[model samples]
Target: MIYLPLLISITEVIIVTVPVLLTVAFVTVAERKTMASMQRRLGPNIVGYYGLMQAFADALKLLLKEYVSPTQANLVLFFLGPVITLIFSLLGFSVIPYGPGLAIWDFDLGILYMLAVSSLSTYGILLAGWSANSKYAFLGSLRSTAQLISYELILSSAILLVVLLSGSLSLTVNTEAQKAIWYIVPLLPIFIIFFIGSIAETNRAPFDLAEAAVIFVFFFLAEYASIVLICILTSILFLAGYLLNFTFIVSFIKETEPYLYAILVDSKHETILSDPIIEGMVYGLTLGLKTCIMIFVFIWARASFPRIRYDQLMSFCWTILLPLVIAFIILLPCVLFSFEIISSNIHLL
Candidate 1:
């Protein structure tokens, strides 16, 4: 039975990974097409079927390209960098509940697991920079390391708010809590902070200091891989990844049955329309769509904003975002406690 479950997990990983990888591939193509259209230029029309196969062509190109290693580079660490990044990036999906009880391995410490895995990905970047033995790569790596570490603080703080509000570290539970109102409304500031941190974490435009290329298209694939992971994580965290029903339902549920707001409470147990497969599909699709949109916004930002200086970037996070986030963390509990006190007084009256 254990072997069967393991086999099933392997199969599920293959099933989920193939589609996601394909989507990430084509997203690049679609992004280029969209950008080209905006600039009034013909995009990849020469490839198969309006350039739909262009992504595949690009993949082939990359595969065929020489894996050049600097003579002084630490070959083992340098190669391990991308492998570590790719593995950690994919590991996060295991806990991301696509639907109720539909994840690959739903655990009690799902959120914490994700945090640990995400933090592990930073070492890959650090290794890449240090291994390369190039001035630009080292600088890029330093910037990336500092940026990820600092922004991770803000990210974890924001996620901690959700964990506190929902009172669980499980992704499914978190999604269930949002069935009434997405956490975004009550935690809008955290949402914004998380989003900014995500962009920085992925090293997207305005924060792409790590792989910023003045002469060469340096580590472009690795950079995009990081961005893809950030997009996935963003969907998993803030957007309520497999949860359906809107903010109105969440609000209604909270107003009427406040006590039943646990993460996986299943308040609508009496509803007739319950299908696990269908539910899983819906949740997966919802998550996939949200991720796609987030990735689009990432590309849009890259197109729209010029990159900031490294000092300005670090200053913004430490001076502005970090302080604001700290303040919110300190204040949120007090506000909630005050509200509870006021409610209790009214009832006593």
Candidate 2:
């Protein structure tokens, strides 16, 4: 009896983690293919069917590569850096609900937990660079630390708007709040801010000042894993997760609900439509589709834009994005109160 819960937890961890690791692997291939098409060049087509196996091959190669360490580096902290990054990046997924009751560790403060975990990932980068005992690596880490800190403010502010409207810090609650309407519909500017901040937060190109020391597979995995997780978070926060909540789709589904129920239900038993397994699977797919769309946008931005200089990056964050985000943060509440549109569930502290 004592081991039962432990076993279940371990199983849950596997279920949540394996797919993310797989997605992180293929995201690399997808980015390559996406960029190749954009540039009118062929990507890794020869690795497997349309290069689907390219990521696996690359993983194998990385695994087989010789490990090298800086002679003067603090070996403990050096190796610990990537491990810290990858663990914290993966930790954010535990609270992200894939569907109803599908999260590994759903809680009321899931959004806050994610933010905390993500913030910790920056420390790993800083440690990795500083521990490397190399001038260039240390400089790169410093740059990343500064960039992540700057953009995180804009991202957190944008999320606060969603939290205000939803009246909850739970990601699941945020998704449910959007069942009739997505936050993106009214908070488009905030969504834009959030999206750009996410790109910078993840060190994506055009704002990729933190992309260094990719020779370490752990670093590679951590980076891509963060990218995928961020995309999913974006979808859940702004796009309504699996529910979508589009008016036409909602009405269309409503019109077809009976037929879908009749077809999907087992006549001998109750409808599978309400079955947790079936509902979870369907919702999972819907959320996945949204996440994929967000991932494509990430890749698209990478392909479309060139990396900005560090000074320009800092200037844009402080001079442009910070001011705009601050204004939105200040004005959004007044607008909500003036319109009497704030959720009644929200309470002043």
Q: Residue-wise lDDT of candidate 2 within 32-117, one digit each (tens)?
A: 99999999999999988999999999988988888899999999999999899999999999998888777888899999998999
Q: Model 2: residues >4 Å from true position, as ranges? A: 213-215, 245-272
- Model 2 superposed RMSD (Cα): 2.7
lDDT tens digits, residues 1-349, model 1?
Answer: 7699889878999987786677667887888987787678888988899999998898788778876788999998888876776678777767767777877788988889988987998887888888888988888787788888988898898887777677777878777767667777888888889888888877778888766621122245545655666676666666777766735565676678766544423666432224566556667778878878888888887778889988898899999998998899888867866766323322444
Q: Which regions of candidate 1 fall more than 4 Å away from where they truly are?
A: 1-3, 213-229, 246-275, 341-349
Query: In model 1, how large is the Cα lDDT of residue 50?
Result: 92
How big is the positional error of residue 314 in model 2, measured in Å on the Cα after superposition?
0.8
**Alpha-carbon shift of residue 168 in model 2 (angstroms):** 0.9
The candidate maximizing lDDT is: 2
TM per candidate: 0.83, 0.93
